[model samples]
Structures are given as structure tokens and as C-alpha cells.
Target: MSEHAAVDQEASNARRGRGASGGAAARRAARSGGGPGTQLTYIKRKINVYEVLDEEGLALIE
Candidate 1:
């Protein structure tokens, strides 16, 4: 039981750290004049293929 509890705590801490790191990294990415989420760039290049593709696949569309 103690071993299991320790393992659980470790896992939780790891998850929290990972989440925090990811958020920080995302913020950094958004801050360096680059962001679809950071309210900095008007044009976010991270749009996926489907969003970039047009209905017919010929004309460029937003």
C-alpha cells in the first residue's frame, strides 16, 4: 500500500510538472511574435491541413 501510494504521488507530481512545462512552452512560443493563441499574430501558420484546404482544393481560402 505504501509503495503504491508513493508511486501515485510521483505520477501526480510528474503530470503537474509536465502540464506546467507545456503551458510555459506554449506561452513562449506564442510570445516570440508567433501565436494563433497568444493574440500576437494575425495569421497563425499552425492551421492544420484541413483548415488550409479549400472546399474544392483549388482556390486559396481563409
Candidate 2:
């Protein structure tokens, strides 16, 4: 690939690693739903917002 393509690919990959996906995975335990005792009854193991708690160490001011 050209130098520009290589740089773009690398930057994209790095962004993904440090972007929302990474955060989601790291905080999956808190955001995931479909666990036992939760309101979700369709899927016991399904991950949803209900199971997520606002404890990602980062929050919006507004």
C-alpha cells in the first residue's frame, strides 16, 4: 500500500482501539443488561442499557 494508505490504516486502527468500542468493552459489566433480576426477560444474557450503571469514570456535564 502507499505511504498515505498505510498511515491512514494505522490511524484508524489506533482510533478504534482507543475509541468507544474499547470503552464499551472495558465497561461492559456496567452497561450490559439481560442479566438475572433485571427487567429484561426476553434475553437472559442479552446486554442492554438497563444493566449499565453510570460508572464509566467519565460523564457528560450536561
On TM-score, the leading prediction is: 2
lDDT of 1: 0.70
lDDT of 1 by residue, 1-62 (tens): 99999999999988786564457668788678564454454765775564655577655443
- Which runs in model 2 stand beyond 4 Å of their true positions? 19-26, 29-33, 37-62
lDDT winner? 1
Compared with the true structure, the alpha-carbon lDDT of candidate 2 equals 0.64
Every candidate's CA RMSD: 17.8, 25.1
Clashes of each: 0, 3
For all candidates in order, the CA lDDT equals: 0.70, 0.64
- For candidate 2, list the clashing residue pairs, or say none: 30-52, 31-52, 33-48
lDDT of 2 by residue, 1-62 (tens): 69999999989988776465445555785676525564545746655556344655336533
> TM-score per candidate, in order?
0.29, 0.30
Q: Can you give the lDDT of residue 21 in candidate 2?
A: 46
